[model samples]
Target: MPRILIAILLSCALSWPGIAQAWGPLGHRLVARLAEPRLTPQARAEIDRLLAIEQASSLADIANWADDLRANDPDLGRRSARWHFINIGEHDCAYDVAHACPNGDCVVEAIRIQADILADRTRPDAERLQALKFVVHFVGDVHQPLHAGYARDRGGNTVQVNLHGKGTNLHSLWDSRLLASARLGEDAYEARLRLDPDPLPAGTDPYTPGAPAVWAEQSCRIALAPGVYPPRSRIDDDYLLQHRPTVERQVQLAGARLAELLNIVLATEVSR
Candidate 1:
């Protein structure tokens, strides 16, 4: 009715497209599953604390904490990375290096750093939490077939794909495509995610070799290796038909694995 109201409504409607782009239906499916059955009591509490924070902290918080650790005591945080995002396109090349071995060594380094952080009770809870979130998010990313995909293609960035009509990159497709498809509006989405899963598997240390990253990379290579070259093909209905099942499986596995890792780190807190 009111002009301002109309503008607001229009803006909201317009924003949905972007929202859909970032958190597609499949992504929602994964998150919905994530918020259930796996997180231990402690992990859930930490997740709640994170959710309660009024503002969302970007990945920068995780990276910078390590930087500060390195600055304060070089031996404390020896991890380093050159860039993030696709290696090409003038963006942070570090992001492009999918937690892969040899070239993208930081991913493994991150796991070790996290292990170290968890072992030291002296570390600030805030920093610990930030690092934990990085582990959670990065683990999820690594599971994405494209995340551990081609080096030359910048892990699918060089590939162009059409998503629901608009042109998008392969990396963005995996980032948000599934969540967007779920169509669980924010309120409903958050409401459903109120619950957390059990805990991490016992004696399952992700920092060790052949852990989360290795597993994720192995899976991604299987699913996305064929399409890792240039011209990053557009992902559409046909592609979805063939790969949707694998995508769902990976998303489910990622959520479960993430819960497991949280459980391990928060064992003492949960037990207490």
Candidate 2:
């Protein structure tokens, strides 16, 4: 795509009200926070080295940095707006690189690209640090089902619905409403999540080479589940009861996978 057209398309996409409603800061932070304690020692050390460059404390501190770029740094944000999600729904949740991740702008590819940059020790700390932030944020995004949903509704941003009589879109429904309905603060929510019997994948490779695409496929399937879209415009308690577990599980997995990805990425960094 030409630079001007890319800019115009992204401008319209970003201009959509609540297009960002997916995985609010709390959701992003929750993923990063969950991964902190799970990181391998080596990964933690490397992460610390990078975080120091920014005077940051933990991955959670930079979790939402990507999402905030449009407001905090307009130029880069405009260039990166499309990096957060993909339209795999058109392909039945199966990723077709040409169709789903064209031009390598979507979240799945973004994760890989950023991870590569992060894993290259030859790269400057500033470059790797930004890549680390992108990987963290994009991982959280891909796990949000709609981020990989069909393109019909722009990953549900255009699918209007109601919760408690308030108007919102499906993207926001999952992004904030369903997660927020629990009525617990993020720390409290973390406590509840840690209690899950299956908090992390068992007997599976955390550092799977097919990560971001695989994650996106799983999420797209969830978004395509029967009745995921409410039968009517008004959403009800049953909607929350049905999908909240899915939301929570995705968050947990994102964190788990992030820790694993970091452990491997940093461990395999090019020799200093």
Candidate 3:
């Protein structure tokens, strides 16, 4: 990883984490790192080509650009705030485009639109590169569960809790704390995830290329599951143990699917 990205990731982890969006920088980069080895030759080449425009070298290089928009480009950040997640927990963890995503503004729709832009060879590489960035980031976002969580609590951002003596919300805990609890650096953490001997939970297999809507619904269901809120709203090791596995699995799933998505969009010959 580059020093710049490492600085950004650490900065994100240290700051008021998850104050902006799902999965934070670590999760997004992990997803991209996991996707690297799975890319097809064409996809890799094209990705490299697109990234070269900004002097980037890997998917991880661009993974958190979407989240950094708040500081780097406020107008774009405001325009894309909703692209990080969707509210569907109250709607039975279902995919109702009209209700869950009005005016095609949510993460699900964002992924679809960005993918279209990326797949269009007619589009400028600069534009395609931005699309690639969004697709990488939003795909990871949709898998964070809370990103597709209930609207009532603003995806659990309002559901306060005490984590290791610090005050935060469930979303922030899941986004940064649980992962930070591992106390490993990015390289070591990725190694831990990569070397895990246990099989991934059944549905998280990345080979399954489901639509963004399906992905969001799956995440919403997880967010609404029991124990996620916990008794007395306290976040301790038990909560982390119970939920960190889900976070890891989602990261793995996001990485694999992100690779597949790029493979298709950057295939040797794409149709429009």
Candidate 4:
């Protein structure tokens, strides 16, 4: 009896670590940030519509349907809870952000996928809502710092580093660690973020595919920089201070553009 209990415990311990590492910090931060009221107007309307549907349906049903649909679309590629996973040798990390055939604006693709799934009025309300949530979650992911990072390094995956004595890759740490230490909930963080309201750069248009080029360029700045992993001692506070502007800016851009895209998606339907 004791041996059986020990074996079960060991199995769970091993599995738990793998599961924990999967989403990393960036994933969690994205999920957390989505709870804000900053979604694009279209996303806001869709979210309202989704909330109504969810109230009438089970989330589990929605999850299953999304999983099935994503599996059928090979072009959509991997459904990451965090970064946008691109095929490393096959796709150029820095191709023309617009008109980059097949894999260019993956962020746009994620939104469109959600839109198509939700457009199917016949889907169960529960399933439709789930699809909507996935859309919301995915758009947020594509905007993250390292999501659009380099391909040869798998977005810094090749650079190994230690996080407070724990062995993990640089990409993994950026995806999560850098943001987790912020210690601010959505409201507080968003409030602080709004302190210096800078409009999107002059001449920058969110609707154009050019939007992503802007974001990719931002990520590229930090892609190979030493900051991927700060010195072990600076891991907590200094890293946050150094990268806060970049981190905050990315989140801000993501929220604003998310609203912009959502507005575009729902305009035709909402107008009706």
Which candidate comes out best when scored by lDDT? 2
TM-score of 3: 0.88
- Model 4, stretches more than 4 Å misplaced? 1-43, 56-83, 87-93, 96-108, 112-131, 199-204, 225-237, 269-272
In candidate 1, how many Å is residue 25 off?
A: 11
Instruction: Kindly list the per-residue Cα lDDT of model 3 for residues 146-230, writing each as its tens digit.
Output: 8898888778888899977888988888787777777878898888888875334423544323488888998898899998887
- lDDT, candidate 2, 4-27, per-residue tens: 999999887756423764589889
Worst 10 residues of 2 by lDDT: 13-22
Cα error, residue 269 of model 3, in Å, equals 5.4
Best by TM-score: 2
Please list the Cα RMSD from the true structure of every candidate, rounded to 1 decimal place.
11.0, 4.5, 7.5, 7.5
Residue pair clashes in candidate 4: 25-176, 26-175, 26-176, 40-259, 42-262, 42-263
Tens digits of per-residue lDDT, candidate 1, 217-271, equal 4554543545433244555565655555555556555666655666666566632
Q: Global CA lDDT of candidate 2, please? A: 0.86
Which RMSD does model 1 reach against the true structure? 11.0
- Candidate 3, residue 134: CA error in Å? 0.6
- TM-scores, all models, native as reference: 0.58, 0.91, 0.88, 0.62
